[model samples]
Target: MSAPHFYLHNLGVPLLLAVVLFCAFDLTQLDVLISNQFYDPLTHTFVLEHDRLFEKLTHKLPRILPDTTGELAVIGMLLSFAWTLLPKGRFSAWLERVRVAPALRWLTAHRRDFIFLVVSFAITTGMVHYFKSHTSVWCPVETTLYGGIHEKREWFENFSLLHEAGEGRCWPGGHASSGFTLLALYFVARRYRWRHARALFIAVMTLGMIYGSTRVPQGWHFVSHTFWSGIIVWLSMLGTALAFYGRERLSQPALDAPRHAPETAAPGLSEGLSVSGR
Candidate 1:
């Protein structure tokens, strides 16, 4: 296969795995319900008592509106369509400009930057993953609060936003990472005058917050989880940028040399010839 074809083929598997993993994570609680196991907690464990903020809301509307499910279904369809179609248009253009070529070029020119970025990303992801795996508690709330409706129905979880709905629901929020990543990437990609990049970041961040927070009421997660999600994403992005692009000065040779200089003056040396003085 050609280079581009091979690149796409390699990317396709990861993208598909990501989507499947997301779906499995989001729908996990719901799957328990469908298996008639949502009530297992009530049968096997002592109920922990507390005056949660959602007590009143849950009592008022124990079951979600059917239309909510319909709306989500519609939205999902629309997003799938856009994911397939919109990329060829505006999204493609943006990616072309900020493509890995520039990132790699920066790395090739500045080894320090490359080391920093890699280390930063590693540390941030490690922290996030550690917290996600060990710290936050996962108490499928609906199983205890409204187990009747959810029991025997996987689709019921789809009605309540409080129920986790995607893969990595138990992990440091991928939605938050997505939001922060977009913002950081936009800032990196568009450092010039005011642009739609800021607006896009804001919109996505809002969506991430809303999406993350929605999982709380259904007994999906605690408010702390959502908050940490945002914090982790923002910190990870900042860390990555600082590590990769922290160096302020450019390579003096690249900046000082004339643009139209011969290929021999571009830094690389051949045999006895020196790039800077050739």
Candidate 2:
């Protein structure tokens, strides 16, 4: 289907789901099941950092992927675009002439998608950070249940806008956005109808899911925090995709470049979707 219709179809339900999540109070239950302060036999006090395994493996590991890996993705995309900016370079010219790898060819065929990916990731990340900074919601670790510093509070209980003291500044998952934002890839893939798009989508989402999960055990965030993050990224990517590629193209081939991007086979990603979202 055309990109505008594709995006129009996809945004409705996700936006609804995000609204539901924002209004619901469904996190304490999962926090009980997932995170807990530890009992210290010697000190007779609960130790917040008792879980050695989660601390060692899961706690900060996500930082590397989202920070280092994310930077590299942006840089790579920039380099791809940079090749075109100079108008000519020996390596660039040679690379352009050769068949290059599918990965490279995919980038070449869908420059808009790459731009969408980079831009969407940055936009979503900035948005996530904005909420994280502006809202007073505490991280799971900061809540009393998770051996944190603050008492329980609603998701948006004391938003900065209300001029109340923020209970804390940790709502929605940040690092998760690193991979979750790649939801743009799913939309980009469908635009091109690339056979491997499904796999790529899954891989990107799994990375985010894995990264988000690690934070739970460390009390860095709540289950709902990550869920909200997924929702946020989906919406962010969708809005960006619509901007880049919402218009219907004429008779261009599926591989022809257009703008915009977003993802998942969960529901909205149907058979009519082609790569370019156009």
Candidate 3:
């Protein structure tokens, strides 16, 4: 597909969908209404607020999984860099004979992919957390509807202007961003034309929603907060993809090359022998 076509289908369409959903949530009481379902008026708290099992399985595990993946990507990038620096001698020969050589070569070949994943993941989650810290939007648990001190405010409300003593640190859902940031994997997979790219995309979206929904029952965030997190993470990943891969590369189809293709030269090599020469 052409780059413009890809951008329109992938980035543009999803962005429009995000805008529509944002408007619906902002104009209506959907956030409160959905959160209300999980709220227990009798106990004056979200029913699953203190459910340890639910919290562990849903919230803790989901957040940890993506974090672990990001860490692995960083390790991969480091190893790829190291591989490029190895001298062409007995040591290099022994290293290549090691069982892990194939994996290292794969990483070296796709070092840019690992870099994109790591960078995008950091930027996406970082932006969400930054917004959370700055935005004065309260979590569902902090609002009066769910038995808290503050009056319920629409997401668009100017909480900063109110000069409230306790500025809320829960506008966009941080946990949701953790999961949504995995969408970077989908773009990476698509870039390489992985056979399971569609499946990966669906799985990432499902996982993101699952991670986001877990917070709703715990009153950590509203549905809108989760949706907004997805939107933000999605856009961040898209932006990073564009920055890393560029339109021309993104538009091209993956080459039908061997999985064990020979490793390209690392950065700073002769222009004729560089990784980009691939």
Candidate 4:
């Protein structure tokens, strides 16, 4: 496929949708819809909070899953590399014989994947924090709309009118990145065009959604913010995958075709040489 295919189809469409979705969301009351439908006015409670089931689901349960999942990912990579690097030993030899050996074998063949996962996880996740640091968009709990202190501000009201970064850093959700970074796993799995790619994508996204939900009850992120976080990470992962793997797949096959052995005239046509004699 051409370069444009990678940009326009794989990565561009998602980003365009993300921007459009975010902009269109501004026109809707879904934020308030979720707030009002689920939020209790008299008790100032979220209906889901009636039993703290949502609370535990969002606030506590993620502490066990995606939160540690990233660390485990990092540890696993480090262990794979470190153990592979160690001089032959009982433990290292044993590692090569275990269930993990297949993964380690895959890792050995996929050095680029190792770097992509370790690096892109940070890159994709960092964009969320970058927006958080620069954006004035407040969380649901930070605005007076939810019985908080600050007046609600449109996302861009401060442009040109003022210059300081607002205290609010909750625009694109941060916790969600922990889950979405696992999307890198999808890209890695997709490199082999494995059926597991779809499964990995689903698993990682579910992981992010669970983590993203945790902050909602506490008013740290609007549902849309969590949604946006997923979009950003999804787009980022796709783009990075394109960058890392695009040229290799596009060019390697053509280059792999053995060049025709130097073309030569038939023996009879070779500079008047006949087939029978030189």
TM-score (C-alpha, index-matched) for candidate 1? 0.36
- Between prediction 1 and prediction 3, which has the larger TM-score? 3
Between 2 and 4, whose lDDT is larger? 4
TM-score ranking from best candidate downward: 3, 4, 2, 1
Best by TM-score: 3
lDDT of 4 by residue, 1-278 (tens): 66776557656777787778767766677676665655667977655544577666666676566547567667655654653465677766687777665565444444455566777877887777766666678877667887788876655563223344677777677778777887887775555445456667788888788787667766667777777888888877776776776644422212222232112112212222222222
lDDT, candidate 3, residue 183?
88
Instruction: Compose the digit string of candidate 3's lDDT tens values, residues 1-278.
Output: 87679879878987898889877898888888888888889889898899999998998777778989999999987786766676668887787777666666666777777778889988997777666655577887887777788886664564343344247778787787888888888877666555576778788888888888888889988888878888888888888887876666456565455232333323312222234324
TM-score of each: 0.36, 0.67, 0.86, 0.72
Cα-based RMSD of candidate 4: 12.1
Q: Which of candidates 1 and 3 reaches a greater lDDT?
A: 3
lDDT of residue 42 for candidate 1: 46
True lDDT of residue 188, candidate 4: 57
Instruction: Supply candidate 3's per-residue lDDT for 139.
Output: 80
Per-model lDDT: 0.40, 0.61, 0.75, 0.64
RMSD to native, candidate 1: 18.0
Give the distance in Å from residue 137's predicted Cα in candidate 3 to where it truly belongs. 1.2
**Which ranges in model 3 have alpha carbons more than 4 Å from their true place?**
159-166, 252-278
